[model samples]
Target: MHLFADMLARVHAAAAAVLGPSADLTRIVVEPPRDPSHGDMATNAAMVLAKDAGQKPRDLAEAIAAKLLADAKVEKVDIAGPGFINLTLKGEVWPDALRTVLEQGKGYGRGTVGAGKKVNVEYVSANPTGPLHVGHGRGAVFGDALASLLVAAGYSVTREYYINDAGAQVDVLARSAFLRYREALGEDIGEIPEGLYPGDYLKECGAELAADYGDRLKAMPEAEWLPIVRLRATDMMMAEIRNDLARLRIVPEVFFSERSLIEGELPDPFSKEPPKPLVDVVAETIAALREAGHVYEGRLPPPKSGNLEDWEDREQTLFRSTEFGDDVDRPLLKSDGSYTYFATDIAYHKSKFDRGFADMIDVWGADHGGYVKRMQAAVKAVSGGKGQLDIKLVQLVRLLRNGEPVKMSKRAGDYITLREVVDEVGKDAVRFDMLYRKNDAVLDFDLAKVIEQSKDNPVFYVQYGHARGKSIFRTAAEQGVLPADPAALQRADLVRLTDSGELSIIRKLALYPRMLEAAALAHEPHRIAFYLYELASEFHAQWTRGGKESPHLRFIIQDDPQTTQARLALVQGIVTVLASGLDLLGVEAPEEMR
Candidate 1:
């Protein structure tokens, strides 16, 4: 059960009764008090509604407080500050909440806020030109965890990756691989040109091409040979990408190809080239927008600097993005008479809409921050206002050791690959450390600190919290005070858990479902990471206090077996919640630290 949600509902009911059914309760919120001494929870029903209800703020607060006095859960209600109503629930409620945690176990935080609504999350759509870098890794882990969070919140989510195979970058990759093929054919292609990729990763593709087709590809012209090599290189690169994602336990359900929107009539890796079909999605999409009066022929305003380097000022096909929230209209075609990247992307979003998804999320790199407004406008224009696009921008990551910057290995690639970081530290550390901050904030990943056993290392600290909880259960079992199995521990009377330290863990566990719901709704998976850190901190604090300050407060009270069972039960509840939250973030919760 969501304790805060229950209190929020109760507060709303009390507000409705006091205001005689006309009060605006939309802004009313029941949250924890800033000072725990003030109360367990607080609400602002009077301050937000008093002006509309024709009463003084304090008077309205008193009336609502009086109404709330009848609630069984709320033990005390005080009118603090100008109008705040702080509530202290009966102490037994905390134990009951913990009992619910034990009853639910791994499913403790599961919620139904989404009601099984379909949500399409497109992320890590990095081009298949090379291995995914750490920058791409941020979006990959963020999107994968966001998908998991939505599923826990009862949303039917589709994890998708849009393959940018139709872009020019892949063409450059094909050319780079072709150069490597020449080298494989005993030709010294001196220092790779500025326009092509120089990564040694492509040598394998070149070797495979040389073995498969021998000189057959070389016999054809660039126009014919490039397509076959492009397809082959893209296929191999995507396979490598899938293996990388698998290393981190991310397997996207859909790998949608941007090239598929257009007919891949270039050539098959084997057999003769398929004939080009009479389909151009880009043209069809532009025509559809033109029919809807959203597309037009216009020239964009000059750059803000007013700089023009042999720029042609001719009219081109434009989308009236200004009609939406965009700052200016955007072009659909370039000067070379080919579709712009935005054009094919508009088609991709249209395909998603056609597949029956109205709620869409696009996870992109920070460099694409400026693209949000235009893409949102495009979705509005294409989906006819039925589709909503929320783009999450992930900022850059700086790899460092201690305080100094960490350099990439020159042998791997031009930049640090996600696989390198994941391989250096295990996948759990890579994922959790990345998500420890908000998605938009620039991240500093320190290689030396994440594995440390101190409080500074969040992944280690949280996992230690889970491990320590089990350690307590083991200590209790040695005293013959509790059962060895967790299921057996659940039968311990939770009401015996009356210590302040014990109830503190219970309150923290009760907040997990609420955190999951908020994180899922806000599309920020980082909140789960932050909440786990706080929960672990609380557990560690209480554990240290028990050992150092008071022996009676410890879990294994030999004289009072009842209290020992209860404390062990609370530990089980803590471990259960930490494990559940960690799983949502694709992290590991170890039972033994060693």
Candidate 2:
């Protein structure tokens, strides 16, 4: 249903006919003009086709433009800048787009980019040791928005959070909570001993422990009480984390615990199959790979920089990740016989493949960049080359307030919590600001800028656009010019919306479907955020243009109810698109933000 896709199809058919069995139109690309003055759309078909056709680029562009000009959709075609064919479509197509936008409402941008395939998006798999900091916030927002974008583009997506509760980090968290529990029992516990978590957030876990067990736990030894305290404390921390995620409007469909991967029974509980815990799954996977000649016993070199006085050379179980494109073979097991984190991760992904999700995406921080290739190798080897893994690395977020950096140190227990930021600037500001920049680019989130209710800020700019459309509907109602029913608005004589300002707004509305498909296919939600800003800017400019030019161009018309209803229909389309785009980014499209 995308107008651009339809136009491109027509161009492709015509180009194929002209070339007559000699040309491949797969390389032809149609894109919006970088400069609006160029045209509504531009294509590099001629430039791309000329090299193979043995003709000069300009000569080929002229020929393509001649063929396209005969089409009913093409109002005008111009050959520009060597070989680009710029096309201006007829104005009649725009009102139909407006009607479509209004009819579909929030579903206007939905598309079939994923073709009903099942994809698993694993993100925000933070350790249950502590609260998510600003760094985690970046991945959380990017992953959640990317999942939503995939769903909009027709993928059956499973949003997953892999909890790292099986690692040494949880042990530290348990010990930290144990200290707090003792302190809660009125024991004179000295200064939060070194190498333990020092965050005040664990204070509540301590209080909960006291409420559950009173002073009875104080008499128990470390080994006796540690497991009970750890389980309860970890559960409490996870609950707090869930609450924090709720504040940011992020909800993962599956909270897959790393501990559960090893502790739980196998999928076929009644079958003779052995209980495949995460660790056992990894061991079995490695054994199977060895049988297939993909796993080998190997020795790893010492670290490049650190002192290796304690480093002992020994053969270890290794995955031949280099054969599948990793830089080197990866160690599946450490020298201590315990499975490395990567080993468990391989089993985790194999589980995803076993469950029939061949397409997988993992959203990780930039620090995890080194891990991507090895993970992809594991997915390929385990799935027998049937499954694919796409890892999106989200760069860091620099938190700022009033142009000054917000300094934080996790080691010092002074890191800014995601919940605190959500509370301070509100969820809409946090989500939009986090997604305003590309995921791989460092984002500068200025608290003051996000909360500002002005055009200078994108969140406010888009929200104001939706609110302005609502304001017009309210004004039309007050003037007794509002449509009596949805059908009345649908039957609007949209031809009256022929003014250049109105037509430009309608053109922007027409771009939503195509933009959604592009963003979803690229796995980039920032594109939606950027598109909403541009759409809002166009609507605002059109509204402001009417103020300076014809006052009759205003949305409300006291004496002309037909024209007023038509403009109101256009306004409704704009609001629907703005709200829909914001919804994908997890931002609020407020009716009135004042």
Best candidate, TM-score: 1
Any runs in candidate 2 off by more than 4 Å, and if so which?
A: 19-28, 46-64, 80-83, 210-225, 265-279, 302-312, 408-412
Q: Estimate each model's TM-score.
A: 0.95, 0.91
TM-score of 2: 0.91
The parts of candidate 1 lying over 4 Å away from their true place are: 20-27, 47-59, 80-82, 269-278, 305-312, 484-488
Task: For residue 392, give model 2's deviation from the true position in Å.
Answer: 1.4
Q: Lowest summed-lDDT stretch of 10 residues in model 1?
A: 264-273
Q: Tell me the lDDT of candidate 1.
A: 0.88
Candidate number of the best lDDT:
1
Report, for every candidate in turn, its global Cα lDDT versus the true structure. Answer: 0.88, 0.85
